[model samples]
Target: MSKKTVFKTASLTFLLTLIFSGIAFGQNWQTDFQKSLQTAKAEDKPIILVFSGSDWCAPCMKLENEIWSSDEFKNYSAGHFVLYKADFPRKKKNQPDTEQVKANKELAEKYNQKGFFPLVVVLDENGKVLGETGYKKLSPDEYIKHLETFVN
Candidate 1:
């Protein structure tokens, strides 16, 4: 093989690896709030706790589809925040572990007593509440801009 062809193949392999790894990493959301808090403090990043009803809530599904799953949000969040999900799914297959369910319920008592379906709570590294938001009819960039106001 020629030098240029070998170099091109290597570069293509590296790019494909990065793209696939990014996609896998972007879907990672912590189930443990304490672990997320520790990571947030260590990384000097904020915590974004999403209280979602993944199986039943339309708004939660919309939030996931429209904002959280977007590449823009994933990229920004990967650098800037410790992501956590306290999902309260109605379906049995979608239910989390028992300990996770207990922890999520405890969190709900403190942050979401009224039980909002798609509540998003932003907190500082020390777990101080920075802001709360939910299901806005904005695109990913617009939603990120709105979050930036609270986080910054």
Candidate 2:
């Protein structure tokens, strides 16, 4: 192969690697509440804790597909919030470990006592409740604007 061709291939490979890695890392969500809290404090950002039943809840799936997966929401949240998910799946295959289940239950007890699926609770670094929302029929940009009202 020509030297120029080899160089082009190498550059393409590097670019593709970076692009895929960025996509993988951009939607960072933590399962551990304490770890997420520590990260929120360190980053001096608020926490957006999500409670959902991934396998069974239709609204939870809709919220994730329509809002969380959107580029607008991802970009807006990437810098402003520490994301945490406490997923309670009904399927046996999707069940988390005992410790994680217990931790998620504890988090639900504190932040989601009524057991609302797709519950989103925003909290400051000190864990004070700033705002709470659930599945809403809004576009990603509109939803982000709504969240900004609570955060700012």
Per-prediction TM-score, please?
A: 0.87, 0.87
User: lDDT of each prediction vs. the true structure?
Assistant: 0.90, 0.90
- Model 1 per-residue lDDT tens digits across residues 1-152: 99999999999999999987786456568988888889999999888889999989999999999999998888888888889989999999988889999999999998899999899999998889999999999999999888878888
- Cα lDDT of candidate 1 equals 0.90
Specify the poorest-scoring 10-residue window by lDDT in model 1: 19-28
**CA deviation > 4 Å runs, candidate 1:** 2-16, 23-27
Candidate 1 positional error at 110, Å: 1.5
Angstrom error of the Cα, residue 64, model 2: value is 0.8
Candidate 2, run of 10 with poorest lDDT? 19-28
What lDDT is reached at residue 4 by model 1? 100
